[model samples]
Target: MADIISLGIDTGGTYTDAVIFSDARGVIAKAKSLTTRHDLSEGIAGAADAALAAAQIDSREIRLVSLSTTLATNALVEGQGQRVALVMIGFGEDDLARDGLGEAARAGPVIFLPGGHDVHGRETPLEMERLQVALPQLAQEVSAFAVAGYFAVRNPAHEQRVRDLILRDAGLPVTCSHELSSRLGGPRRALTTLLNARLVGMIGRLVGACEAYLSSRNIAAPLMVVRGDGALISASEARLRPIETILSGPAASLAGAQFLTGLDNAVVSDIGGTTTDVAILENGRPKLDPDGAMVGGHRTMVEAVAMRTFGLGGDSEVRVDLAGLIARIELGPRRVLPLSLIGHRFSDIVIPALEKQVGSVHAQRNEGLFAIRTGLPDSMAAGLSAQEASLYARITDQPQPLTQLLTTAPQKSALDRLAARGLAHISGITPSDALHVLGRQGQWNAAAARLGLDLAARQKGGNGKPIAADAEDLANRIVQRLTRQSSHAILEACLTDDGETGIDPAKSRAIARALDRQPGVVRFSLALDRPLIGLGASAPVYYPAIAEELAAPAVIPDHADVANAIGAVAGQIRETVTVFVTSPEEGIFLLNGSGETLRFVSETEALEAARARAIEHARALAARNGLAEPHIELMEDADAAEIEGKRKLVEARVRAVASGRPRVAN
Candidate 1:
């Protein structure tokens, strides 16, 4: 019999990884490539081709293809995505304030229309005139539209109507609240839908790129995407609801950590280019977050691993704080291209620019910064302000020093706006550069890293002195600061997992003293109960120190760097369907689920219908996910109260879950 090989691909912020795996032999080969943001397909193809070549296997031997990515997570963390307009039905301005929707909108246009549905899925006269007038102009201003109606979970009629209109008129990707989640909170659901809408174009491109590449290779295999919950779903499903993939990469890492280390109880921390994700594995499986996946401070209703994502990573922008007695270095919540990387790619431009800046008489504000076009098509530049457009036009494929690119303060702001919109990339001093300067990493130009650090070292501190004596000293300081921040991030995740909400790791004196190993009359000591399993290409370099600080044993598996890719192929196909039965009054039960609402006169009839529908939906979804005979599990939660010696049925939720191994191609 021929070996049944599976291809797993993971696209992270900095690198794209690919691994070839077989059930009998484990990982046969793995390869990595720098992620090409201009066109992700370049990175995907590079990694895939390298892996296939390394394995010396025919592409036709691959039976399954699974993918995972951190693009959605990184986009949220960095506040970068396609601009989208939100259409709210039957929601007032006050509703926007309820779920951080206004803040999440982030200067995006929002239109409130007078239409909605009641608790029982009854229409409240949807107003089409406002949407008709606003959509055309909004389409020019945004890449997609989100339509969320009040109580859309109960009745999606209004939201569906608006979605159809947007699709017909704007011909843009549309996300309706009901399509994403079955939750009841209108504002929160709207927020999820809006975020999903923002990600549709981005995620669609990613999946489309992978599919196109696969088709070109003639590697006929079923494609699956890892979900935020560490399960496999059809690529088509993921393209429509990308919000569910917010933690897809992290979740895959969690699965890979377990599969590689075989540790039942451990704290799994995966560091990537853009984020450090931490989660606890218990009973040989990752725990699910009941409150939903929270990324970049927004709690989404996407079911995912109980992972805490931090913005500290190798490519994190390094900033200095000179406001105190001693200057302190801080790593990022934003990722910047490492000077080493940009220097390697554009050495002529980068080295000369850095050398000039370091030799200057005075320290320049933008000495070590450069901006380059991200290589996305100009169509994404829609709705750019005049200043933003002008600055963007000046940026080209070649790297331009930010000092030369921005002549004035307004132009600097405009450049920033362009970067935020993903039209441009800013390269600066980062932990990766620090690694290069320290000689720990040698993949890029170390001279450029030294030059960038020299510029950073010249900055005045709070004590009115240079922060460091030399470039190496400053690079060490930056690396040490990253280590400290990473420790704090791990500690914070541990505290949150232990349900110690009152003690903030950043401010907790006890934790600080413990981490600092400060000796006093009252000595404080803390340690994690479980060992730490570190996964990432850079994990071996950074996690040992972090584990020591936490007083936990560190475990870095052999293939830790390619863990996400391994997990992508090792996951199982799983699908879930939920049905809700609500009683508006006695003797009338309304069932809601699977994007439809049905009324039944009797409670038994309503429950039976809901159960049957949920099972059917789950089975269908499982089949779509490439599962044949999935094991099905049914769970029901019914809320009832006893009043005046009578049993009252308030509501009931029925859920069906189907899961199995993905089918292999013949």
Candidate 2:
């Protein structure tokens, strides 16, 4: 039997891609299957089955399996997450609705109490009786809970106390904001915790499914999920903080793009069936957007590659202005054409059956018998009648011209007849109205099929239909315009602070408005001299072409279709823990923990304490990350200032390093 191999799978919007890698065979095999969003496990199982079969390996020979998913991200974006509750130990009701925190709180219930800590490690006093009363009152309704405090990062004791209280009384999963982030901003930190809470159940189930799948395949190795930053962490850790995986898809693509292009700097355009994504990479690293990015409609602060999305793709609904005579805009690949054009090319059920039953519209002599009907305007009908004799004379000699005439002047009633054809000639409905319905909410496949027939009956060609040259130009223009606008919005968001003046919104808006210049100035353009590469099936169709047209060398990589899965395959385990502290006496700060008194007499001591804490955190994470006998290091900082009689302060930083056993050859 072949040596055991690692399996990686990524579930995307349209497809689930799986890859197998073996030391002996190098890259063993890769497989793709349609994604079943209704039940992701179906798509995963199908992809896995295909990949294993392609590699010619028995399920028992598989050593490990890992998955990179966009499920959690999707759930958050589509507002399909569980109803969660936010518990604040010492925060006001208003805190839950502050800045980034407001976005997460919007997902569920929020409860605030009087118990908390001051800037120093001292307690701010709590209404314990009220908390006890509230815990049971709030517990039954929420599936998950998030607990955050004003200075939880500096002193998590109060937060931990609140968590214990909630856990004992509510029996619900709880995430403390301080544990998730060491950042100073309370609202952002709280938001991060709330997001983690909301995704807890979804991620847990997803990870559980993967685990079961792996065990069934006899895979013994541990599993790891890639974070939004393109780094890896243990499945257990990922389950706790699923928000980190929100941007893993794009990050992985950027990573894969970096690997493929071998360039230090460039811009990448990744276009998929649903949307087009553009990002800039410098020194082989995608820039991380610290401020929250909007996914679907909500904002999340997950580490993600900064990218601009355009609602334009091969499957985009092409809009046409049938309403106006002067300004008719032809929209879309909105009409996803049926494969019946070649006439019974395949045995694909409906489309094939439809073509056989109705015959070709181009071949029919009777206008009413034709499958492709036309909805002609009064003006166009007049023109057609004036040229009727000439058109009829040329029909046998120049059928192509006759067809062109019908394209320009379609009859309205014929459209209704065409819609009734059903399985005869129009099976795949591709209409702008149908596309709008599909894009909005529910499945409109049936409606789409009907609309496709109606569209076929409409005038095929008009002044609204642009030539191929004009289409290419238009695609490029749309890409440029959307990219500039989204990027400018992000830049403007990044610049705004509590009070400090930054990027002027009006100026940014002006820049976004004038998007006509090809290769125009982006608020944040990459060094394209080095080339930016894109990954994903649609990246080639949308990104690379746009980049090239913009005078930038762009590369859309092979296997870009499954780069996210590849990222899952090539990641390492990681973890992080953050503890907070507050000031006590003048020039003295105290750590709020369970153990010994970690007091900082000066700023140096406070900084040292933070470093030591960070190192300890990394070591613990290393163990969870499957690192045996993990080594560690520390780095830290303290923010302190004099106020009245005492110096108030806070401490923070990170300590991280790699630690893992070498893989043994079989």
Q: lDDT of candidate 1 vs native?
A: 0.90
Superposed model 2: Cα runs more than 4 Å off: 1-4, 23-26, 128-140, 273-277, 290-530, 576-583, 586-589, 592-597, 600-612, 629-631, 638-666
lDDT of each: 0.90, 0.55
What tens-digit string does per-residue lDDT give for candidate 1 at 587-661?
899998686789999999999999999999899989977887999999999999888998888889999999998
Query: TM-scores of the models, in the given order?
Result: 0.98, 0.68
Least accurate 10 contiguous residues by lDDT in model 1: 500-509
Model 2 agreement with the true structure over 273-368: per-residue lDDT tens digits: 434455667776777666555554445556566654444333333343445443233322222222222112223433334343345544332221
- For candidate 1, the per-residue lDDT at 378 reads 85
State in Å the error of residue 294, model 2.
6.0
Top of the candidates by TM-score: 1
Query: Looking at candidate 1, what is the lDDT of residue 5?
Result: 95
Clashes of each: 0, 20
